[model samples]
Target: MRSMCCFSALLLLIMAPVVCQGGNILVFPMEGSHWVNMDVLLQALHSRGHSLTVVRSNKSWYIKEKSSYYNTITVSVEKAVDQKFIQKVIYEIMEYERGASRLVYLFHLIVGMFGTFLESHELLGGFVSALLDDAELTTYMKDSKFDLLLTDPCWGGGAIVAKYLNLPLVYNARWLIAGDAHLAIAPSPLSYIPVTGTRYTDRMTFVQRVNNMILHVITQIQLSWVIKDVYQKVCEKYLGPDCDYYQLMIDADIWLMRTDFVFDYPRPTMPNVIYMGGFQCKPAKPLPQHLEDFVQSSGDHGFIIMSLGTFVSELPADLANEIAATFAKLPQKVIWRYKGEKPDTLGNNTLLVDWMPQNDLLGHLKIKLFVAHGGTNGIQEAIYHGVPVVGIPLFFDQYDNILRLADRGGAKILSLSTMDKDDNFLKAIQEVLTEPSYRNNMQRLSRLHRDQQLTPMDNALFWMEFVMRHKGAAHLKAQGNRMPWYSYHSVDVALFLVGALILLLFTVFFLLRCLCAAVCKCKAKRD
Candidate 1:
């Protein structure tokens, strides 16, 4: 018995280290930005016993700092050539200057494609080229082995690295995946069945249905072009001829979307395309003492929190003056994140700062409304904190995001083009604050949006494990790749109708000819 006990103790000690060493996950987020969602995901994975390695461009400020959650890797890319030089070259080649600039813009598109092909979609081309050429990046890739390559969809390099290393790839889409049917899990109003959960009705009004159909068709065309022209060539170059771009993106072991089903109404979804919505969100943090005092000083009248996010701060001076004037007259105090030089005659009630801790400001109890440019991250934060918004969407997906929020009665959508109109700006602020319905609706959404029993971090971890346990389950997604465009749209019926019409016309022609010939024969006989 003593001998047996000794043997058992030895076995237990031997197996302990093996069980503790979990799989390695490498993460690459977009350069130069602090997307809270990505940060939460990395933290969640770390808690789950997985070792994480985060690779980022030096341009990214987030990576410059250190965190205990994961191992960090920074890749420095070359300074991009001037935008003017790129524009000139593109105009010379394409002979067009509309939309995005020709030269520099074309480089952005091509490099983006190349990055996507390489699976490092987060890193821009200039950055990717710089990293690929860097001795440090090459050395890191050669030495730091990992079990899985996880990346945000914005960075295509993750895909590239996954292909090169022949490792499993997991894509975390900051928004909806624009293309790739496998990753395209949002539901259509026209579809009768719900793809993710069956609790909600999938029906839509006729106009809504038509609009959705058109959007889907347009998305399909655009995605096809991106896959063929951008992703394919890059994949061929890095992954060799045997690799398939469509299959690589579509067949990702897991596609995690950072969107909530409650917000995206009447949309179809799939199991494989996991909706890890609000993964980056957290309960509101306590307000700073000075900010608290500022809010309390406002008394019964509330305040507005204005931020345009990080990327675009080029508000025209006239528009800024107009906003300042509008705030000057309002009863509420305003906290604006303005990067430009401070105006000399700033209103008494308005506080303009070069930077503001957005999440903390929005969480303040005195903040009655939010004024923003409707970026996804900003919108999500506002929604998470139950703050009603006045969204002035500038570009990209901001327009769609703000419109969707407005449609839900949780926010108001205004255009920057008309922001100079003091009446419009003031009226918008009044409507947002006075309207009980908007507040009620926003609170209702907040409940639904926040009711996710699992925080975004937990959801991400759960799905990550789900992928490992079940390798590429069909029940998780629609068979988008198996069907052609005709099949997807049920265009076979239209083809059948056309074929039947042709057959009927031929039959009629044949019958007429026979009757005419018979009549001629009778006439001849009579003669």
Candidate 2:
């Protein structure tokens, strides 16, 4: 009987499916470029014992659902943020054109700004919108029975679902998560923390520091207002009146930032916020034979890879022409990801495609350099492959990303405003290709980025599982959530100023008393 029992136990141990404490992970990526990170997260979760499901659109190849993985639920939300109203406002701002319709544009800007404010409030407007779409998402949640929710900060819908379901929420911040409170995790030095890795010029003039401080103050105020008004309203509508949206915002069970401590120094990190850098993407497969041959044919004067990213597909014709003209001058071949109408006069050396396997191309040994729009994902790919870049930042966080890359000696920044200048374009490309420092720096950064104990995806998976196993883990959250904003961050500064004033008043009083005494003594002596 004992021998038979042992044999049965051995068989069960060998055959039984790995049970992982009811681990179910629901991943939500931002509208676009989010797939870049989500793909890795899926793989990491699968590697562990967790069953995973991804919720995203089919916007880019990065987010395309793979059947080999657990399950992928496609959620379709109109990319309305990039609507005509928003585009027109952006056009007016970019062109600096004031016309009879300027007031209309200004109004739209105000509305858009207000909308953005609401969008930032994960608790209020953001959450309300998601609750309204509950029918579409609830099915997935119900079927999956997720133990934890891993969502991008931008995906207020996921956050809402997590709150509604009462699941542990882990905010996967792809970029810098800047907030007035210390608990918010930023991925880059653009955050207001005076930490070490920030590249803000040490010898900055007083004027520059003042300007920076003003900018920081303005950003903090705007963000705080948006969170309170927009996010709070949505939270109250869905999560009930008793729900403290402010606390929910701060009580994120875990903050998984896609940033490395090596690249970003002097990190002002909280205990719950973990650095999960390089989770943006995975090492891609080898290039196709034909593509490999084409790259090999270029020899030492390798090809240049150019991409404007998904959001900015419709490049101005003039900009396209300038790019074409610049490519015409290069001895090496050029592979351009152009989504618009192809030009009649194409450069012989240029290869235009609607899309190219960006990661595969970047990994090519024949690819000498990359010309990019300075998107975070693109930057990561470039760094991962140890290829230098010529960054022409278009908008949003691109400006900051390009600046950081340039500061790190891994890329050269070409202001898109001046992209019309052929001299500048030519010079930028030439410098990136010829400069040995750029390559060296990229290689160094690559080492630092990859030389991690756990990849970003691993860290994300670990936390997702951690949250699942531990339940809410709300105890790890900061106490700042309960305190008023003024009391939380600025009370010390306020106290210092108040103390200085009190001390100054006391000193003045003492000086006045001494002077009176001296005058009285003089009068007595004279008498």
Candidate 3:
């Protein structure tokens, strides 16, 4: 009995470190595709023995209230930023794209999106307010003693929650309330680092740089007057009148950025920011029997797979028919993820399903090309698997995402306005398929992406665990997040130097004049 007791004590001693490493993490994630990314992180955390609690809306479209990986705290709200709302907004954007001229489309796009953004924020703000107002929920949260809060800051609620709880904050982020995550945390010069909407590369033409500057100013205005205004009210009411919403945003302990150099242009990044672009991707799993048979039937030709992402389930009927007809003509078989009514023109070679295993299909050796809507996740996955893309950019950052790949010689982009006109979609796909350069360039990128010291997921996990172990990564956090705009940009320093230089010049001029007068007086005296 004493020998068994000694053995048990030894076992406990051996396992103590593993048991102590587990952390209690609180997550406030964004909905739709952002949640997909966050879910991947949550799964990794769960596998590492971390306890997770996800705060989700009652009307959440994708986030389930119950999951094996994490417990959920569901907040009730009058409305949610659900799929239906997004679908309606997307439909409106598509209509504008198809029906209007370029000038009119641009005007309507800006104005319409401006209102939509404000409305979305207002809804998210309301949800946050509801979560905070619930005395029981807030009390429970305080008592839970969560080590840190992980969130996607695309919406402002998570940042507000982290501040309210005084939790060590970490972000699984690419977009913030205003725009791209880099603009919020990094030194993004308008000269090279293109703003979110502009589809310009790092090497911009003179005119493009001028346009970038104009857009940068517009973005600043939108952030200050529009986006920041929504969250400022929330912060003032909940935290205090002294709280700055913008600071709360930039003050995260770590940022797991969903981009890498392979997919994104080189730009300034903060120390706490870790690029985990394709962390969610993995080697291809064996396809379902039916899918494998389909792939095998393609044989030497291989196959093409197209998915426009979660929000765009179906295109307009005419556009769908046009795409279907084009796919029918291709010799290679096509697997399309579409939920719209069957296009009368859809060929026997084309198979339409409601969903497809996107990453798995991308990694498959038999897959030849990807027809995508140019989402960040899709593009990164394409790069990860060495699959070339024929891009159809719909809205938001889709154009910019595709432009990066096109500039890198791995993609062909077709604008929505011209996708159906003169067989543009078909031609783009054919070009990507027939051209050897597209595959070769993308394969090279895949090698570069894979040639990393540590896997992106492993790197992300290390940083997350590091933050938990250290209470917060305060050492890694930059003080720039705490500085005022004038201080951060060094505007005051520049002005001070300019003023001092002017004063010195004036002093020298006055002294020279006095010297000349003295010399003339001496000459007169001598005469």
Candidate 4:
């Protein structure tokens, strides 16, 4: 009866009429070329006549233009943050920290990132200050009163801005599932929804569940005590002495996660989380004339596209040489996206370019396999195109992303640390290329992904617009958000059942003892 009542109420809320009007949106892209999903969303919103002003670093990749259609606010972040230093911190921990366990690496990752945050914009004066320090920009924002904030919370700048300006902040994620989502909004079962640090599947072993749960609890503590303190200090310095930091996040509008039920495991989700995994992908464009000729020349053999995305533009020269030699013996033509010095033993069967249209090449009919670092965007694109992959994961979520695809039988994962043995790369390449099953598996995955009733982009836009129209969609916020941990895990219920059982056993034992004593006394009297 209660469930039916709740369902009816929710239906009324959904059916409630809202004014379908446009909004003034402010977008802050994460500091990189990796904002592919967010970029797609922004373009779609722009096309629908919402006024958008995007803030990004000068070093970032954006469509260069000046137009009333949308605006760009450039801030110089090169002096504020070092990309190479950040990358090195994560890489060294993942690669050379052999003495440390995965959990220890996660701890160190948090510590390293925390220190990095303290040194960077989450301070009194840095890149963030640059954004607000601009008198013209701040004045314009104050006047404009942006109705919504589209931001990547991983960057930390967005959350600060949303609180400072009192705007509705919608968090954007590239490929991470963090604990903050569980504590802040959803009911995340740690046994199924693995932490960002671990690569456990939906069905986790007992030990894996224990570790994931520990990570989940510890992450919230770190956020509450460590990260939140720094953010509060920053807010106090700029916003006001009485500024509310964490509440801004806990009460934020929505979470635009780049996840789909097709790619990810079945798990509970919040009303605010909108999953649109393949938003970045589009219908494949016709190949360039030169590339068309190159692919055509492969004849019976096909080609492969190899890229580790923008963050990993270079590799060790020795590793590059080995990769080139491995591809040389294969019948497939390889388009290797290498920005470093060319390997001396590079072969004629390979075409080396600094940049390749990865999605387009994957869509090509003759493209056999993807040689990737297992970035989420690359994985999604490969799934979209029905191409099997040879994954060379480097750091962070790359290994995890590959794990998911490999689990689905469409990709084979190779460890970058053990790439010294030539057979590791060669065997993986040969297996994925020769096995028809890999191809068939990927095609099945593609069908599942492409079979959505509403297109991923349309689904994303609808939820976002719905939120905007409904004045932040508080009606959609889950009522269970504030339930205590014990209730969430059913710990209280278990305790109650145990207590009741103990009481019943004690009562039965006492009654038996009384009866035995009474019977003994009566027998004694009769004797």
Find the candidate with the highest lDDT and give its number: 3
Q: What tens-digit string does per-residue lDDT give for candidate 3 at 351-440?
A: 898889888888888899999999988999999999999998888899999999999999999888899999899898889999999999
| Model 1 lDDT per residue over 62-100, tens place | 454477878777765644323333333333322221234
Per-residue alpha-carbon lDDT of model 2 for 503-523, expressed as tens digits? 999999999999999999999
User: TM-score of predicted model 1?
Assistant: 0.75
Q: What would the C-alpha RMSD of candidate 2 be, to one decimal place?
A: 5.8
Candidate 2: regions farther than 4 A off = 1-22, 47-49, 53-144, 175-203, 490-527
TM-score, each model? 0.75, 0.79, 0.96, 0.82
lDDT digits (tens) for residues 388-466 of candidate 4: 9899877667777888888889999887666558578988899999999999999999999999888888887787776
Misplaced by over 4 Å in model 1 are: 1-21, 32-34, 65-67, 79-143, 174-229, 468-479, 482-527
In order, what is each prediction's RMSD in angstroms? 7.4, 5.8, 2.1, 8.2
Candidate number with greatest TM-score: 3
The lDDT values for all models are 0.65, 0.67, 0.90, 0.75
Say which prediction, candidate 3 or candidate 4, comes out ahead on lDDT: 3
Query: Stretches of candidate 4 above 4 Å error?
Result: 1-22, 58-69, 75-78, 90-125, 133-135, 174-184, 238-244, 482-527
TM-score of 2: 0.79
